[model samples]
Target: MNLFSDIRDLVIDTLAAMQGAGELPEDLDFANVTVEPPRDPAHGDMATNAAMVLAKPAAMKPRDIAQVLAARLADDARITSAEVAGPGFLNLRLDAGVWQAILRAVLAEGADFGRSDLGAGKRVNVEYVSANPTGPLHVGHTRGAVFGDALASLLDFAGYDVTREYYINDGGAQVDTLARSVFERYREACGLEPEIADGLYPGDYLVPVGAALKAKYGESLLDKGEEDWLEELRDFATDAMMELIRADLKALGVEMDVFYSEKSLYGTGRIEAAIESLRDKGLIYRGTLEPPKGKMPEDWEPREQTLFRSTEHGDDLDRPIMKSDGGWTYFAPDVAYHFDKISRGFDALIDVFGADHGGYVKRMKAAVSALSDGKVPLDIKLTQLVKLWKNGEPFKMSKRAGNFVTLRDVVDQVGADVTRFHMLTRKNDAPLDFDFDKVTEQSKDNPVFYVQYAHARVCSVLRKAAEAGIDAADATLGDADLARLGHEAEMTVIRKLAEWPRLVDTAGRANEPHRVAFYLYELASEFHSLWNRGNDEPGLRFLQEGDPATSQSKMALARSVAVVISAGLGILGVTPAEEMR
Candidate 1:
């Protein structure tokens, strides 16, 4: 049960009663009325802005309105006390039984306690980790993968039909560069000294791909010219790189529902269709854009080209759709891809891009808006950089990736669970420092260890109770007389549990998975604090020597806390620790 929503409804009902009594006008809109926690805990448990929002609309003084609303709210059983505070706000303190019922609901629901239906079954397409198929995934891709995967899970829990997608950049010139790089390795495998050129990939990760090429083609293509083997090598190398990327993602426990190819837009009418849709709205035109302001490139020229009027849809400037040589711009295929998503009947589209792609956000959103005619909304989230530190210094680089740390290197050093949890400790757009020494340290500084320890502590309590023959199983605890749980410390734990449903809705609405991690850390902190309080007051402990019912009730509350933690961790793709090993 959402106690905040429950109490908000009570406040709304009381306002309606005031309207009936002519204490407030009938035409005042209550949409802006909100009930939330007071700024100071000593003021009240919950505060409402009913008087402030309605005062100007109803042509009445705010304090006069709050005084009448407070009297009406105090008549409800759920509201134990209501008073006007400051200028106009109405503060409310809910009855103790309301917090008590929330604990019982959590125990009854298990891991499903905080699941919400706010999405109402809308279809959402989440596209992420669309890296070029030139090499294996690196540490940057790991952060995007974990963020996107957890976001998809969060929307799913919030009742959205989420589709995880990856856009393969196989149709780009980068894949052609990948072919030439593999060809050099192929020569090295064929008993010839390879040319390690400046623009060629020099990583040793492609050694196995070259070895496999030797196994497949042998010496047949050894003496062939560039034209005879370029296409074949391009196809072979692209497929091999994709296989490596998939394995890298699997190592990090990420799976996509679909892998879309940029090549699919080639020789297809999809690009024309998407452009035509924009042209029909007068958004496509042929014109030369003004040279970008300040420090113009040497090659900047006023050449006429096909452009999209992206400025009409909130972009800073009109974007080019075709180069002067008549080749499609890099953004053309992207427009077609999002058009395809719209055609698939998704209500919304979300793209997770790196911080470097921040420049592409506006034009892409303009394209989708024009193609869908404002029917489908697009949200683009840009993830910032990750800095790696160890031994009191920055980790230099990865030998396999040649430029950065590969996802495999991080996962191999610390297991996937630790990597995933640590990556989400910050928001997607915020810069994160991944310090190897700090993350793996077994202390409160490590969030992954701290949260896992809370779950393990609850397990230890149950195990001890079971050894004492106290029937401490979930089924037994759920059926216990919860009214015996009257201690203030015990009620604090229950109140925190009641915030789970509200927290789920908030995080899902903002499309921020890091909030779930932050919330879990806060919940663990509260649980740990209550555990320490038991040391000062022995009667507040989970185990009471002479009272079975009271002990079972307290255990029930602790178990309920465990249930919510497990559920939140599940959304983060983290396995709740049964015992810390």
Candidate 2:
């Protein structure tokens, strides 16, 4: 069904035939040969570098080989012409019937047209949005959440066994701070004036956690010391905050398959086991780290510490696993967590982190490399900051979240579909500007609206064709006289559709889901252009006047565009618009 792949295979088969006819050497490697769209459409439909790549290796002139290859390819029914241009590049022009067959393939396959098996069912663990379970998720976490969730979906479509995961940062001192903040709210709920001290979480979201704690423990636990209440309240508050986090994710249509707790690694011998595994490999040692570059800290001094030889595994320097006070450092638990992931036998790992954690990327990768002995690959994607705009100025923060904008605030204002689509307009490594006024604007300038409008227009076409008593169902239209779709505008759309499978494979291989968003925009642009062209050219319209036979063929092409859009939007976790409001 992938016309590009089909054509590429034809080119490779023809090269093999040329080798058999003694036109090229038998030892020439064909791995470098590639068939893709020509850089300038005016040149041809597709281009191949088989002649150019094999010329020097086969000890023959590129044009001489291209001439022979061109003659062999011209014998095939799919290729109309293969012309040698500029040294050795072979540009190919496919027959019009090839595009007709592609349209029929789209009608037959529907949403599953572009699905690929690129990963071959390899297990991949994608961990993202592992924000601290202290309060509601803010805008930074929102980008990571959307990026990670969409990546998981994209990989799933590309045939990877994806496990959507969230690593809870609940084992650190941040949770203790959360417990103290909830204690203040608990006092307020008990009719006592609470102390909203500095360094405590002041968000009103904790008000309910306090109320729930009061209902469960009553006045009995209020008089206890920190030792008695800290552990109990930390567990209670983290659970409540996680519940709030879950609801926030649900609003944005994100659901994790695994919520791995960092606390589970503590007091479970898992940390020791992970460290011991590295120790057995001679990667653990006790040493004093060199002073950091540039200005030294005020208390700079060398001290003996337990360190991991992270430099051996690609880190910039060895990292301390234990502080001078003999307690585990902040990175110890992270090492244990990744070691556990390796023990589970995943073939690959991907972590989606906020831009602030860019420095942690190398060390984390080193840990996984040492733990897995370089058997698995770890890909860390950092989602950059999002700047929200509205009313000609930066958007205001959520009062409920205290200082930052909550995920729910964005979703509630612009809706989940718009929020999700707009968030992915930029790549994960690039900064994004989310303009509230612009995203909701129903114009071509707005990508989300333009793409959704295209889907809605296709639905309108289906409805109109059905009302006209023309059978436009996939099965009926799939068998229509697709040869009537010979117009350049119609063929342009089919050309874009043909790139779907190739696009899926490329995006999956690079771990970039933003490419899907970009492709959808281009496909929508082409579809809208053809729809507009139909106004003046009567033969270009999807529904022909009083001719169901002609109308069905064109309607089939329009419906195929909708099918691909739905499939692309599905990967992005955005529901396709049935009708535009």
Candidate 3:
């Protein structure tokens, strides 16, 4: 059960009673009224802005409103005390039994404890890791994959019909470049010294692709020019690179529900169809954009072009769909792609882009807004750079041009679990420092280890209780007399457990899955503190030598912690550790 929501409902009900009694005016809007944790723990468990929100609307003083609302809230058995602090804010303290019920609910729910229905089964398409199909996924793509995968899982847990998607950039010039790079390696495989061109890919990862090309064509296309072989190798190399990319993603515990081809939007009347949809609304027109501000690029010109009135839909500038030439611009296909998503009947769309794509956010959002006629919402999240560190220095890898680190390199070094967990330690837009030494270190400094150790500690408690012949199964613990869990230290951990549902709601609404990692770390810290407290106070220990009832009560708390941690880790696509070495 969501304790905060339940308590908020109680507060709302009391306010309605006040209105019925003529103590407050009728028809007051409580949409903005919020009940959340107090800024300071010294205030109380939760603070509501009900009085403050109602005061101005009801034409009454905030303190006068708060005094009566506080008294009305105190009448509920669950609320132990309701105190008005500051001008009008009401702080509430809940009964100890409330926390006990939350623990029981957690044990009963198991892996579904923190699941929410906030999304209400709305269709959400999350497109991420849409990297160019040129080579293996590197560190930058790794961050997007982890963040997007975790976010899709979070939305799924929060009751969204989440579709994990990858848009393959096979229609771009980068894939053409990929074909030429592999052709050079093809020459090297055909017993000729290859010319490693200045703009060609130099990574050794393509060595196998070259060998496969020879095995397929076997020197038949060796002497052919670029015109004949370019198109053939473009398709062939794309398939090979996609296979490598798929394997790399699999190694990191990520699987997309769909792999959409960008080329599908071209030559299929889809681009014209999307533009015509906008044209019907007068959003598409022929106009010349102002010369780009600041330093003009070599290609800048003043010519009539087909542009979309993106500024009308909140974009900074109206964007071009087609240049002065007859050919469509790069953005034309993007507009068509999002139109395809809208046509698929998704209620919402999310694009997980690398930080460099920040410039495209506004134009893309404008496109979706115009194409969907402001019906469908688009949320774009950009994952920032990941800086690798090792041996107290910046770690560099030459796995690709620009000295990029491969996803396989990171995953192989510390396993998929550690790699996924550590990558999300920071938010998607915040630059992250991936220190090899820090993430694998078996200490509290390592959040992954700390959180995993907490789960392992609960397992150890279960084993110890089993050896002592105490029936500590979840069925028994869930039915135990949880009233024995009254100590302040024990209650603190339970209070944190009660925040899980609210956490899921807030984090899911914000579309920020990093908050899950943050919450798990905080919950793990509180649990570890309670475990240490048991050392000095025998009554707080999970195992009571002579009292099976009290031991069951305490062990129930430990198991409840494991339940929440397992659920949280599952959202992050990291396996919960039964035992950590």
> Tell me, what's the RMSD of every candidate?
1.6, 1.5, 1.4
What TM-score does candidate 2 reach?
A: 0.97
lDDT of 2 by residue, 1-581 (tens): 77777888998898898889887779778888888888897898899999899888899999999999999999999989999999989999999888888878888888888888899999999999999999999988989999999999999999999999999999999999999999999998998988989899999999989999999989777789889999999999999999999999999999999999999999999999999999999999999998888756765788999999999999999999999998999999999999999999899999999999999999999999999999999999999999999999999999898889999999999999999998999999999999999999999989999999999999999999878888988999999999889888988898888889889988999999999999999999999999999998989999998989999999889999999999999999999998999
lDDT of every model, 2 decimals = 0.89, 0.93, 0.92
Per-residue alpha-carbon lDDT of model 1 for 1-581, expressed as tens digits? 67777788887888998999989889878988888778886787789999999999999999999999998888888888998998999998878778767877887778888888888999999999999999989889999999999999999999899999999999888888888889888888988887878888888888888888998999788789889998899889999999999999999899999999999898989998988888899988999888788846776878999999999887899999989999999999999999999999999999999989999999999888888888899999888889999999998788888777999989988888889998999999999999998888878889999999999999999998888889987777877888887766666677678778888888999999999999899889888888998899898888899788888988988898889999999999988999987
Cα displacement (angstroms), candidate 1, residue 526, comes to 0.6
lDDT of 1: 0.89
Off by over 4 Å in 3: 296-300, 400-402
The CA lDDT at 310 in model 2 is 98
lDDT of 3: 0.92
Clashes of 1: 0
Clashes of 3: 0
- Native-referenced Cα lDDT, model 2: 0.93
For model 3, give the RMSD to the true fold.
Answer: 1.4
